[model samples]
Target: MQKVCWPYFDPDFENLRERIYGPTCRVSIDNESMEDCTVIKVDSVNKQGLLLEMVQVLTDMNLSISKSYISSDGGWNMDVFHVKDEHGNKIRDQRVIDYIQQAIDTTRETLSSSSLSSPKAKAKVYTNSTLLSSDHYNEHTAIEMTGTDRPGLFSEISAALADLHCNIIKVHAWSHNTRLACVAYVSDQRTDTPIEDRSRLATIEDHLTMVLRAQPTTGSQRATPPNQQEVKASDLQGGEGTMTNVERRLHQLMLSVRDFDEPASESSSSPMMPMGLGPDRNGQNPRISIEEWNEKGYSAVNIKCKDRRRLMFDTVCTLTDMQYVIFHASACARAGYAYQEYFIRHIDGSALSTEGEKERVMKCLEAAIERRVCEGFRLELCANNRIGLLSDITRVLRENGLAVVRADVETQGEKAVNAFYLKDISGNEVDMEFVERIKREMGPIMLAVKDETRRQSSSEKPTMPFPSLGGFLKSRIERLSHNFVTIK
Candidate 1:
């Protein structure tokens, strides 16, 4: 059970009172539900990344997801999953089940705390920026954007595209020194054509400009500016609600570079290369090198690897998960390879202080880079969008013993064109026979999703929450003030 602080009586007491009485999330595992698996069911309020968090917890518990059904009605979320222990049997240990429940309960407590007390930042206005035009080839129209980096940046841009009815095809984004640069290839979803309307393009640009300069609606930590401005008292008092677990985790992990105002006591004059790791002379494999700038109080990491979709996202995700706060970073691809450099320190505002720490980090990074370069299978799936489709697909992948190294999931014009880069459980290449087996197993499931979509369209009445600009604006504001999710 989560601890409660019941010391004071004020208007804020309502929040505490509610927490004390909030609906308790029920998590239970039934060992006899399936022939050889356990069924775990969870009933709770939904939030962004909730499914992912569940999957992570299960994975950590040595359980493999075989099947899942996720649905949300009104505001409540009901999720059920069929899973097996590492030995491919039903989980019968009461202690393990209790542990799993506790982990999930902790996730909810963290979510609630963040939503109740997250800070609000003031919004800034930005000048209108010109949208990019296509060249002679005209493959796709691009929207090139550069802005101050902040939490929920991706979600904000996605919301803007959805509002404009622009379909995103592909996106490449990079961040460095508190700035983000993104280029999105997009189309008009309704027309299925390149965005040609000048007014519409202008509106798209305007919306993104507003989003770029806007205060973060999600409770992710605000990116500290160079001056390390303190949060205003009013901002703390008037926090927006409905923060996600991911945002809160990020807020806890990230320490803005500007917070480090002290000079380093020691500095390295030469670049530090990995002692036992190096790229082949033929340049067939990825390479990683780490150098500590002790005087500057951070480490400089350099990576050279094959460029692939979602590579940047994966790299950032790994660093963030490892509790490294990036102070400056840059990446660029050329000649079929990517070169990335990062200056980073520990989350606690300490440098990699010891040889052991440096060595461990270097080894972990090397393994990560190698896993990306390892031989893998790629599968592309396209279908009309359906609720919980991604969750289903991810569960299928896990059930097949395939680890997803990278994935790009985007929906355009109500159609989702997704890509998955996968490898076997041992991080080795999968054979063609295994690939065929995956396709054969997933074929029916994919077909079923499509059939379900058609059936729903034929039998159910459609309703729009916002049918006019007034309602749309109101809904947008409410969403922004609460939990804002990316449209995809």
Candidate 2:
């Protein structure tokens, strides 16, 4: 019998290895790999939430990940992503490539500097504006609200802010499962500065809570009691009060309120479930499955749904916030559908063990994906920013019998660039005549109808089989081995 020699483990050797390779982050972009997309390769020292940081960077740039392979183990991470622009063309712009490189480099530096901190501290550093340039949470007051959603809820909320002498600088709102979550950035209307008066902030919060508590007559039944409605106001000035990304905050708020729970009256005919191209060609809704991988000590999550922009970001963000760590994952978009698989374990290194936990995960993932669905016509408005601009616009929408399913409001310099996904009050398609009349009434607002069909058409191309988990893992291993051989 041959004797087997076991390698000795040394603490000093481990410390030396950390010193040698801990701060290394190498990102290479290959535009010539495949004819359809750009291949991005990243190798770095692994840490919690690193995958999410990278994915957020790419998705924020409006880039689509057509395919990707992720691996993070043994204090190192390596990932390869096949990405394309929104136009379904290979990335040929040098400026965009350089921007991605810079963003990744900045991420690496931030992580390195915060290496000694807790995982939560590192997450805060990455989520701050150090890696992504955002003006939404700067020099403004942020108002967060979660309650039952209704048709004219936003109109009333905006009116309350306007009455409080607060100007809406930007707002992001989402509705799902008969619940609404929104974050509105507002400044003092007269001073154009953050709202600092505690009394006034209290008044604003109280007034909005009343509006949210007001029941809707023609939508899904209100499940939560009026007294339980939540409204929070805080100054988002520089320093310790900085908030995370508005969308992520919205997700957190919704999850905190347990929006994933299916209401008793929820149905396909509910106004909250606006009909459109949300379902795939086969008329299938988002399918999510979670199974235990006992061999690997991880829970495998698989999701299949209609592909859309920022899909990966939404899923990964939800998982990270839920205290799950993704160890290996694969994502691919073929035809009009997205297929994603993730092997994840709790932060405590335990796989999901209960059926109830699996059900909750599935529901949460489904809700996250549905929150960002483009359900109605996208109306974009670009005009000069003014004290009551958002209020005026939303009032027009409400008066015209249109309801905003989703909205993105932003201010660039003196310009208020806002986009709203609009449907009729009954959740039916909006009348084009109404849109035309509103365009004429709102003079100089520069309202235009975006071509939603173009996006749908882009996904209607050729189809391909989604790679199975076994095949994906095999290919990933082969690719990693090839890289190791080249390095040696």
Candidate 3:
């Protein structure tokens, strides 16, 4: 059995966290029955604080952390725990270790599942700045704003920033309605905006607030955003509870990933250009920026594709040319190219005057993404605010043996972007041709033909975790590791 450790063992914690209640910090978990509890071990550096956080994960997984061991080593700290619940099927089961592993993997993956992103996991995760490996970039504060979802939402914000001359650096946008208002985050490169320019920022926020509050949001989001604190600092602490043999292995893998500041540097191979991936005008700067121009529906028209130079200013120029306002931007890239996607608020509304025009715009946008966007080896297709059979898509993909590794679901109004990060069950590269094949197959499924509609109805049973993906993807990984699995 591998040893499990902790991350919440901060250096200054010991002198701060209280242990009057018997230094209860470490978390122990039983996989087979989630309720099977045991003791835990922790470190002296805020042992209680670490354990307190561990309990959250345990609770989420339906387990419990009773007692723990807390201490510190050199500069690093560690926590171990022994927990107990009424459930004891784990120790009796032969596959308990497998169950534990599944739990750990699920918990680990849960934090990053695209379906459940905090502001940072947005569809557009970049600003107009350059992508660099500098420390200053990571230290910047990140914020996200969400309200009602609708159209012209992005443009309204862009307009507000235009008034402030605050360039729209980057935008990761999501909406839940054809009429759904939207939520977007803009990062400004005005790094020198005096550390005390509190008023300036507030004025901008006020502008955005007014813009959003004035928009319409219907269906579910009409209610206030859930008050249950969708985010918590403890969630960021990672899990600190005790592990079954399986969880220990999963935990080790996760530890290795986080042990470093960045995952293995992204391979420097040519970027797989599905969207706008090509040389720009300067040939030395691939920092092309796409602006939202479709009046009724947002649009990203290809601006430039060139070389590897600082195209921050030029990127800004493209946004200005579109008569869009920049809210914020960041420095980002792919394959050493000076690449970044900007989110500007356009001045005009949807260029469409009728339903047919809007439909045409959406169809064209979908086609562009399908033919152009490829991440790693997987092609991504996003559909938002449309009601169509999603289950049939999952089944056909399963038949094709493509397992989804991650899924993120977000709703703005009637539209929800269900983003799936998938891969071939057999860990090999999935080529463009294969993606096309799936698309061709899905084309029929997307259409509600009589037979297809019947099939969609049968497959549309309320989805399981991921409807059809969770099982194949999870089990495939377990097999690749040749580990046994037990469902808890």
Candidate 4:
């Protein structure tokens, strides 16, 4: 008689196996491999959102990804990135290299561990803590606000905070689709510490809510009612609350307010619309399309737009936040244009099946790409750090009829380094004469203007059209098959 064979089961075997050959990550940086950019190669066990996590790290360090090749097949991921510094030069700083190595290693370890299943663990792993200043994470209070966008809006908000004896230590603000999102870090003016009083926090929230809900002087219609606008002031000094990334928080704020929806008629007339959504001289508005990859059971997303810094971060962040899993992707930027293709599916392993879903995805992607387009002249201010400095500077700007389109404020030890993109309140080019006068009055040594070349109208068309989806997939599959054979 032949006995039936039963499969052996050992509970401890799984854990032991994981210890021996589980999720492992290796990262190497090669400055010699590429002539114009540093090459970073990563090999690791495949998992959802891994690509986005890696991209976020590089972007936080202000590195520009000129080209990247990403693949995740058979439960393993291999990625290669060609990166340059903000000046479009290869990275040569040893300190930066060490930081990147450490950060990526930490990220891998965190992701491989079981703790990542929790929200707090995910937040800790993804927060931009390394790029922050030397101060402790809880040194300042975090303020998040979103409402309708208008000229001089930032000035009014800063003035209100100053009046409440709050000092702005760090701030990042962005305006898109007639909506505004701001994240500001503040401290008490007298004590130079995070504000802890509950009443004071409530007062701060109330004051800012009013400022955001106030009617616009420029006759722009409000997007939402006073009760609908969001204003929150939180003390980050204690507890286990998840610390949010400033840029990611801004993206979330804008999305929560449905900034990707069709812009109001009044918004279409704003200066930002023409530059952000209208066709450029090449007659190319951001082209984003999605099609079904039936054989692969994926949705292929293709995007073509003017290349700029942080483009990868924005798109990846949007996709990840939307609960999509990217199986393969490629990005290449050349000659002032960028082309990106992604093969993705829903987290549940389903492709986008409906027209409404595909359309929403495309609109969200467009908004994400356009949110960071600088709309006006770039202004850099370097001076001694002091209380009420931001308020004073913004007051000056408001008085000069200059509107802040985007702003980044930081404090490094005893110095303050701030940058603001400004446009005339009347939606015209900034007056150089007025800028010069303001510089003279506000200490010419402290403020400097950097002229940005305006986007000129062009009658010429694109030299080549975007590649067809069928051809792109064919090439991608061929490349992947070749890689598989070579690896074996």
Candidate 5:
């Protein structure tokens, strides 16, 4: 069987470099008709992960999204959201909107500037005027890529585009015949406009071609027969996890920051008992043990498990997300075993001295490791953009007791494409019954959104596109008050 590769996750710094910045962005918040809710409207150049980032910012600000609509036509993106602060009040502050606009604008500026300084600029370029004809320059720059499918391929392509200062407007990807094919519509990041510079366009194309052609040293590549597979140079160490060749090199480079003068003694080594966690599921047990060094004022964390592609990313991302700071770390993989150790402190510069905190950290790490090892069922859907579409889909999943492990949603033209990786709330495979129930609930909601959109456009007198599903749900909920008088 072909080995499936996990998705690639770049360090936080790399995420900034990969961010797509729109040339023009406008944000406005108003509260006229909605009660205790603010309506936010945004128009900008569409890019990958843009919506999610916006959502994150709002979430961080303690705002709840009551309803939302997102649409992208070619390069332009439009989004409307109804939100309320934690206190259940509309945000009437102009300064808040200004802050959001400024944040997005700064991101765009950074993306544009970073692309102009890509390392690929130093590489040899072949002139291809035909690819940049006037007609092509006026239209969206179309990028078509084909290569052996592997985990993290999408991330690589996205990184290349970001480096080249290309703003992806639309994307369609599929895997077939053990190969991947992807086509994207992109625009010039600096102008939020079409590609007019033939030389620049040619350079972008060349850079992407090179990226696609380059073989990834990650184990995500189709696994060869045991006898035919050649041992990689970095995997010579008998360590527990699978590290890509690039990751291996990067890991070594990062380890240079560790203080080598620290007292090195075998006495501190942990002797953890075997923990049977997901052994039958993924053929590996994720074990994490924490040891505190009172003299050093830091905690030592040791992790051992079967190495898989992007294992390092999964571990690091979990640690960072949990607000842990790694003062020092080492990782190695050999003979299908991966081992990782970290000297860490909390974000507040405290060690994990509490048993509760240590247990929480271990549990989170185990969950992250399991996710990387065994993925959930992924379903992709594309439909016309509609208000409250996301909310409706999520509600259906909730009602069906389905847990969404991961989701990515983007819009192109008038259609919205969404991919969801699903698991049962009980942490089991989603059976056919659950899948059918979701479909049954989703079918009407989708049709209602589409119907509402059509009606609003055709009617001269503008009407509300669709009633908020939240409202209906609220009405269905019964209220019992102690002061209420019973009437016969």
Candidate 6:
């Protein structure tokens, strides 16, 4: 092979002039060097999180960031880190250069798909365009989209920005084969455009949906494989949970955030896990994300419960005509912890901002779970590692006339997880201070929520369809129309 010089990433970039092509390429690396140390300045708006991922890349390249001040607004993000190699060699090596080049190349290819061949002044200037607002710019506002992942998903979105005279400062895209998930950082339109270009946005979304639908593997490309309990294809064909061809044909889709007027506590009204507390008042009103669901996309107001409640299904998915598939999903629940985590995705950005309605909506989910499982209770106490609090806990419950039925305890990740099934004399399970009592006695809790046992009555296959796909999709679209840009 002919002699070639690689890109440089070290403290001695200036001295590289003596190296082969260095005479003309005179590149000054953004590194602030110190004795036995160096700083590499990486300036890029990471929408696909190239810079963010670069932190890991640097680790793989045997580099370290001593300090970093990163900021991500809209889809564009930036991370300027001070890095150094362990050997204090100034990190001017081939592997470091290669890794940086590879990362940038991958980002370029991803951005090119959206007609963003040149990252120049596109995302930034476009965000300030006139199409979004006639009054003032909403700096904190962000754009989230989910449709059939496509090559021009970025191009079309950026084109929409261009049409609206918006500037795209930064963006992030992650694609696996045929489709992708990307976020673009944009501002108000730079040109004189109306704030009502929503029809245009809808048009772009629809077009991409059709393009994705036309692909042969669109349906199969993004499917979550059935669980161990799921029935076979033959069983699904005639089964109520199975989907018909027509029902599966959803093109590119869009679900905008609809802010609710009430507080979230009141809105999130549904039967959920007694223990799994969804986002409450303190946390940001998270966008709704339905996960591992089968043909059961939920509405915005009802979506939060899916996580905390873990409405595990034996049927289809929440979204339709998707190219991505999930194989196995297991709820990660830990007993006796402060909170249980529910991993999900609001693919369409259907339930956008949490605003004032977050707390109430979450409580609704808790109430639902409590209603279904708390009817008859059991308060069984187990041997806790923190023996001191055990007495206080039991004393509080017993003094208050709470009964203990069955209980077991085990350690999980340095904390104890206890399962208690108890009941009162009247056979009625009712205790408001149940959570408070647990905290008071065995505090520093991680998931002090409820996991009231659920009993599905009846033995016969209750419904025609194993899972209701239509019901899921119906809920997704309706909630998206409710608008609330108001943030606390």
Q: lDDT tens string, model 5, 173-238? A: 443222344445566777766676767866776676566556545433443223212212121110
Best by TM-score: 4
Let me know the TM-score candidate 3 reaches against the reference structure: 0.24
Clashes of each: 2, 0, 84, 1, 9, 86
lDDT of 2 by residue, 206-242 (tens): 6776677776564555545633543222323222121
In candidate 4 the C-alpha lDDT for residue 448 amounts to 69
Kindly give the stretch of ten consecutive residues in candidate 6 with the minimal lDDT sum. Answer: 249-258
Could you estimate the TM-score for every candidate?
A: 0.29, 0.77, 0.24, 0.78, 0.30, 0.21
User: What root-mean-square deviation over C-alphas does model 6 reach?
Assistant: 25.4
State the weakest 10-residue window (summed lDDT) of model 1: 447-456
Q: How close is candidate 5 to the true structure, as a TM-score?
A: 0.30
Identify the runs in model 3 with alpha carbons over 4 angstroms from their true place. 1-21, 30-138, 141-186, 190-196, 215-488
- TM-score pick, better of 1 and 3: 1
Rank candidates by TM-score, best first: 4, 2, 5, 1, 3, 6
Model 3, span 399-419: residue lDDT tens: 554543322233333333334
Higher-TM-score candidate of 1 and 6: 1
Error of 1 at 412 (Å): 6.7
Better model by TM-score, 2 or 3? 2
lDDT score for residue 9 of model 2? 85
Residues 1-488, candidate 1: write the lDDT tens digits. Answer: 99988877687676654434666477878877579778889877765445445655676565755555555434566777777787868888889989989998887767667867844323222132223443223344556555555433544565567667766765444332234445565666776567756666667767776676665444332332433222121111101112122222222212222111221221221111101112231246557778888877778888887665434444554566567766555565667677777777787878877887776666555444432332345566666654434444545445444544334555655666656554443323344443444344442223111110112233545322212423332343333222222323
Tens-place lDDT per residue, model 4, 190-299, is: 98887767667666776787787777444556545444543332222112122225677778767766778755565554533312222232345689999898998999
